[model samples]
Target chain A: MTPIELRCCGQGGQGVIMTGMVVGKAAAIYEDRHATLVQSFGPEARGSTCSAQVMISDAPVPFPYVRHADILVAFSQSAYDKFVAELKPGATLIYESDLLSLDNRLPQGVVARGIGATRIATEVLGRRIVTNMVMLGFLVKQTGIVSKEAAIEALRTLVPPGTSAFNIKAFETGYQQPPE
Target chain B: MTKREAQPLRTGLHFMNGNEACAEGAIAAGCRFVAGYPITPSTEVVEHLARRFPRIGGMFIQMEDEIASSICFQGAVWAGHKAMTVTSGPGLSLMMEHIGFAAMTETPSVFINVQRAGPSTGLPTAAAQGDIMQVRWGSHGDYAIIALCPSSPQECFDLTIEAFNLAERYRCPTFLMMDETVGHMMGKVRIPDAADLTVEPRRNTTRAPGDYQPYATYDGSDVPEMTRAGDGHAIHVTGLTHNEKGYPDMSFAVHDALVRRLQRKVHTHTSELFRLEADGLDDADVVVVAFGITAGIAAYAVTQARALGRRVGLLRLITLWPFDEARIRTLTANARAVIVAEMNLGQVCLQVSRAVQGRIPVHHIGNPGGPVIEPEEILAAIEGAAT
Candidate 1:
């Protein structure tokens, strides 16, 4: 892909930054491409809005900030509301269907899909904390920005050692979900 | 010894942020002492060092304040250890006095200033290149310093090693001027085996106790060989103007010689320390000059400007200090204008203007601090400068 900018936004404790890091690592380390991730958060430790911007490209990813996201994956209602307008026209947006409601204000010509990422993680994976992983899996599957094996390898390195198997299962489940 | 003689390093492609990579670079460079207090954007450098240093037989101290931290590393340096301190703008401001002290006593140490927005306590979470002048001139002195700016995580790792080498080579404080964006950005860093990297060892005096002069240069070299504080060499170090015997001379001749040597050491080595990445400069009408994170954005802007059939080039300053005045003069001589892009209110622009000597206009694209200067803004500046 020609330099694609991706942004993931959620609450502070929702692993937004980790998701961005994993995707960036998958492309940069495993896929032999270039990626840069920049994270932003506030003083509030747990519930504050947090976002991670990742740019993946065949060439060096300079200008690290996401000016207008080519792809946005948001996991909270507040995050979705805050960042939806920053999407480029005809950009792809993926949000948690169970956590966020779409408004009429999404930019024109935007292609958006919603997945019940939190629900799937809580019910199928038995852990709601891996919702970010599920969303990341869904993002990789839909966009094909990174290979599934590459994403799984990144998870193996990033996630806590003892819980890798469980997180990988959540990722696979989310990867199989049909986009809506 | 060269890097080829060191132990094997974790040499492979790894994904890490600039701060974490800096910690790894320090370890690979054989830096054993890190003293720093936690601050926004720069705290990760200490955090990673804290976790890694202990396992590798190094020491990481979270000092009570920036002042204590800055001096703490100098103490380690005197005791024969490679040392560094990490901080952001306000903390760097607090360490300025000690940085001067490091220069005065010829302490070989490194200071990693992951710059954020600030004169005092400005935006702690945002990126800024505002500390460019501060790192150079904040300390009260007529002394020169070696300051390196890294625009990526890989350079963060590579140049941290270079910072240590330069500090030891010149026996003065070296600055790694990073910004919030590069500090937090994650990317692939290919760390080679330690045996393959070039690491400079600290130069210690081989003179006998009676013959050693802590500030002496009997060999005519500007840098005196440093003897450890407790190395049985009757060495005395003080911030005051001292003679070759390391005793305070309080005389005009001694002070002039001491101060001039301190500045001359870095000045004479400008050819070795002044590093820049010049692209499209051989045939260009307008050139963009930038350092730190702004340099990365300027590169992209130069690419876009070139695509639009504009003869715009980029001169990315990896070494912000020592200015590279001769290269700047030659590059701007035939250009219509030069654009100095940075995250501050025209600090580097002043340097560019001085270097250009009014032969051409020097346009500045500056951001007070919050957001980065967009590539389009620089592209527009390139268009304006081209006209």
Candidate 2:
């Protein structure tokens, strides 16, 4: 399989950072590839740009960050505007419509999808934390870099001390919810 | 009695980051104390040592800044303890004055720099080789320093321990120059039982109290035997120019003798100190020289070049400053061409070029920022040399 280079961008309180970790860990431990994760968080933990990169290669990866990415996941308008330029010619972009404006010229040779992640998390899952999981579900559906099962397993391992089932509900809400 | 056998040790495999490995390295090398500031790329080192120090009856502290961090470690070392500090580019720059202090006082210490990209805050959580020149000439005066570069996670763990041992043997502060690739990397690190490692202690000047001269050479190793601060042997410590008596005397005679002794300590002890590796040069007409993470890729390029019927070899530099001049000069002299590849905009490559002169065409692949050089590009340089 051709390796997948992914970049996740959203505000600080979102589980967008966790999305990158789940996919990166799944690619490494489950798919048996060399995986590298690099992350940067903004000044405040509440409402700031938080971004992370995950690179998976069948061979050893030399550099940690990518010049361009094969997939870019943006959960906010600031994020989409910030990193859409970093996507290469044949990249795919998934945006959260509850928070973004998408009127720019869609770059040739790339695909874009907008999903209402907040609606599914608040209405279906009855929690706000599962919103990122809703978006993550679409990512697996689109790329299959990780199975739905493996990504959930990643969440179970990565979440805080006592918050596994809430995250799993978030995942189910995301997996069942559809885009507008 | 060897210290390794003195303690029955247990070893196990664990997935760990580079920072954890460095802390473990210091502990294994008998470093009983650590003081550092909590900075990205280096915070994990402090935390691990802090956790393990209590178990082993050592000390770890999160100090105010790099200056304090540097001095605190030196203070511990002077009190007859193996001490170290971990920092990155800016922090290393801040500690340079004390680095000069360590040089002047002939204090034996170890410093690990988990380097991040920057002139000033370029990227906090990123990798960089921007500190090469700083490591060589950062201190205010003329002194020779020992630096070790490890490319893989395993080497980071091993070389860090070796760095502390070397410092203790020679009573000089050694540098473990690690960039982000190895610093944040996670891999299977097989730590051996304590019996598998050889340990060395600091040279003691207080063998007998009255005869102790802090700066006097015991084995003629250019390194003087050192007495701890409270050994009641009356050791003098200062950053200013000092004589054999360890008092600040501003005489030209004292300054010249002291500076020369510090320089000669690492410089004259060359063969035992320099660390480098040579590959495929036995039948090579061209050579590719690299250091740190770029060295691994360049080696792959050389392998492919040989398969394609070209004589290309690799000279990997694990030591910077003392420059690995002896072996590199010989390796470049035999090859018809030499190419220097690195992450910076030709910093170390310039050093390599100056060392080789015009004995061979030293082609340089310059990358100032982002994206490591591809193997094919290095192979292209090798093929370009062959033509």
Candidate 3:
């Protein structure tokens, strides 16, 4: 792939930074590519909006910051609203359908798709915290930026021990969801 | 000691952030003592050290404040441990007195300053190269220091080991001046096995207990031999100007000779510590001098400028302190202009200007702190310098 800049944003406790870390590790460590991850350094502990920027490339990534995101993965209405303006024209946006109500006033030429990630995690996986991993599964299937094997391997190392099976099931459920 | 016996930590490829990589580098270099209070950006270094030190028979202490943290590491050094302290701008400010003390006593230690926006608690969450000058002159007096800047996570791991090696080799304090961006950013790092690394052992005095003079150099070397506190050597370490006995000597001659030796030890041996990355300097009309994060940006700008048929090159300073004057003078002597790009307001630019000495036009592109300098802005500077 050429260089791709992605931003995953959400509220403080929504695992936005962890999603970025998994994707970056998948690319840099497992896929034999280059990736750089930088997170927002704001007061994120107070449940404020936070983001993590991940840049993936076949070569070394020169700059770590995301000036304009090619792909934006938002998990909340506030995150989508705040970051919608920074997406490049014709950019792809993946968001949680249960959390965000899509507005018709999105930036011109932007392609947005929604998945009920939180619903799948809670109802099917019996956990609400696995929504980010569910979204990561959907992200891998939708964007094709990282291979499924690489993503799954990255998830194994990133998640807590003995819980990888549950998270992988949540991810597969999200990946099998139809586009809305 | 034999090279095989010096190996300490296992090495492998890992995806880690710069701060964690720095902590691993210290462990691989056999650093056994670390003391620091948590701060923004730099807190991860201490966090990683706290977790790993216990496993390796090392000590990690979260001191009450940066003042105590700074001196605590020096005390550990005197007790025959390779010591380090990690902090940000505010904590670095508080550690200045101890840094000066370390310099005066010729204490072998390392200080990792993950710089943030500041004059006084400025943007704590953002990155900045504002502490470049402070690391060189923040501590009072005329003593010289060794400072290294890393541009990437791999360099963060590699240069940190080099920082500890330089500290032990010279028996002086060394600074690993990293910025918030490089400290917190994540990238791929490949760590070589300890057997593949050349670790510098401390220059301990070989003389018998009664014959040892702590500050005396017997072999015409400027660097003095060190002895630990419990080594049965009658060593007296003081911040005051002392003679070869390591005691306070008030005479002007003693003070002059001592101070000169302290500065000369680093100054005369700068070639041993000098490190930089240069590109396209053979026939370039414009040169960009940058360090740390700005160097990565400037390097990209140089490549872009070259593609546009402009004769631009980059002089990235990996070692910042004993400022590479000889190389800078030679590289910029015949160039049309030189551009110094940093996050601070022309701090290193002043050094570049002095090195150029009216031989070429020196332009500065700087930000006070916070936001990073974009590559397009550096390209503009390169084009302008070409004109």
Candidate 4:
């Protein structure tokens, strides 16, 4: 299979790296594909921009960093602004509707989907940190790049103990949302 | 010394970073002591060790500086424990003197340098292969050391164990030369059962106390048997040129013998020390030689070049030191040209060029610092070399 590059980004506290880890594990460990995830490392504080670039392929990923993003999951306005231009033509954009206001000009042939990830996460799960998982669930449903079972299994293994069930609930809630 | 029961291995498939995998590798290799000063791109190694070592009957100390960290683990080694220390470029700089000390004392120890770009703290969070030469000749001395470059998290796990084994086998400072990218990249690593693993037991002397000498070569073995502190052997460990008894000897003859023996112990095992992976060099016109993260990128470029009907191949260096010049010469003997790609400004490229010996045009593709070299650039070099 051709390699697919996904850029998952948000502020540091939004579980951006964890989102990438879950997706990477799902594809690499569960789905029998090779995946490499390179997270942004630096003086990234809680409210600063943080990103995880993931590449999944049938063979081992040669280039660990994302060049042209096939899918972009933006959890904050700054993240969307920072990475939107790198999306490939005819690529998919999954963004948090409550956090990002879509710009007028996007790349040609782009398909964009926005979800109120933070709102649903806070209102339904009573935890804002689960927003990234909600966004991940929407991504899995929309792209089908990884199986639902694969994503759930990956989530169980990656997230901190005692919080997997709640995160899975958030994921399911996002997965069940209408495909408008 | 009695053989201890192996630490229970975390044997299974799991997703982890290179640093985390390295820490697990150390545990699997029976490295019971670690002293480290935390630094970016390498901090995770010690952090993981700190958390895991306490539960596994191991020790992890956060030393005040890299100088202390480097030598602290050697003390543990002398105390009959397999040991390691973790650091990055700046930390490695501070530990240079101790590295030479380890070399002189013939201490079996592992030094993990998760390299970032630097003459000095150039880019703490970014990756580079800058330390390639420094690691080889960093410490002041005429000595040979073994260094391994791991391309991914899996190799990071595998090579760390190899590092310890080689350290014990040769009684020298063995290095796991990792980069920031590999250290931070998350991938799947499969750790095997402890029983299936091949750990090199410490080469401890079995002779009675008074008859044993720390630096005496017995029979055909070039490396001498070691006795730990408190083992009732009157072993004198010193940085000075020592004789068979390991005491300070000022004579040039003694120094020459000691140094040659030290170098010969590793050089004689060059066949085993050399680890390489060569792909598609059978009838290739151009071969790309790379190590660490650059090898993966070069492989991708080789694939692209092959798709374009170019005769391109890739040779990855697994063990960086004890430079396998003969193998490199033999492998690329038929190729038209060679390309050396690395993140540094032509460190390994110089070595490759020397090995090629002006037989073929050795093209170098290098980046001074962060953000790895692009595959297109490497492919371009391959195509150019082929033409």
Instruction: Let me know the DockQ for model 1.
Output: 0.71
Compared with the real two-chain complex, what DockQ does model 3 have?
Answer: 0.66
Q: What TM-scores do the predictions have? A: 0.95, 0.75, 0.94, 0.96
lDDT of each: 0.88, 0.77, 0.88, 0.90
Give the candidate number with the greatest lDDT: 4
Error of 3 at B232 (Å): 1.9
Give the runs in model 1 whose Cα sits over 4 Å from its true position: A44-46, A85-90, A103-110, B1-8
Q: Each model's RMSD to truth, in Å?
A: 3.1, 5.8, 3.2, 2.7
Candidate 4 residue spans exceeding 4 A from truth: A44-46, A103-105, B1-7
Residue range B27-123, candidate 3, lDDT tens digits: 8887989999999879999999887777678889999999999999999999998899999999999999998999999999899999999988899
- Sorted on lDDT, best first, the list reads 4, 1, 3, 2
Q: What TM-score, to 2 decimals, does candidate 4 have?
A: 0.96
Candidate 4 lDDT over residue span B1-387, tens digit each: 333334558888878899999999999999989999999889999999888877778889999999999989999999999999999999999998998998889999899999998879798888999998998899897998999999999999999999999999998989999999999999878899888889999999999988888899885678889998998999888998998898898999999988988889898888778999999999989999999999988988898899999988899999999887888999999999999999988988898888889998998899887889999999888877777
Better of 2 and 3 by lDDT: 3
B1-387 per-residue lDDT for model 2 (tens digits): 212233423265533556777777787788888888878777788888777777677778889999999999998888889898899888998999888888788888788998877877667766777788888799887887788887766577888888888787766668998877667665435578888887787777646887777887877778888787777786789988877778788999989988888888888877667778888888889988887778867876886788899988888888886675666787777788888887677777778777787677788885663455788889888889999
Give the clashing residue pairs of candidate 2, or none.
Answer: A134-A174
Which parts of model 3 are misplaced by more than 4 Å? Answer: A44-46, A85-91, A101-111, B1-10
C-alpha positional error of residue A78 in candidate 4 after TM-score superposition, expressed in Å: 3.1
Ten contiguous residues minimizing lDDT sum, candidate 3 chain B: B1-10
Deviation (Å) of B252 in candidate 3? 1.1
- Residue B281 of model 3: what lDDT? 89
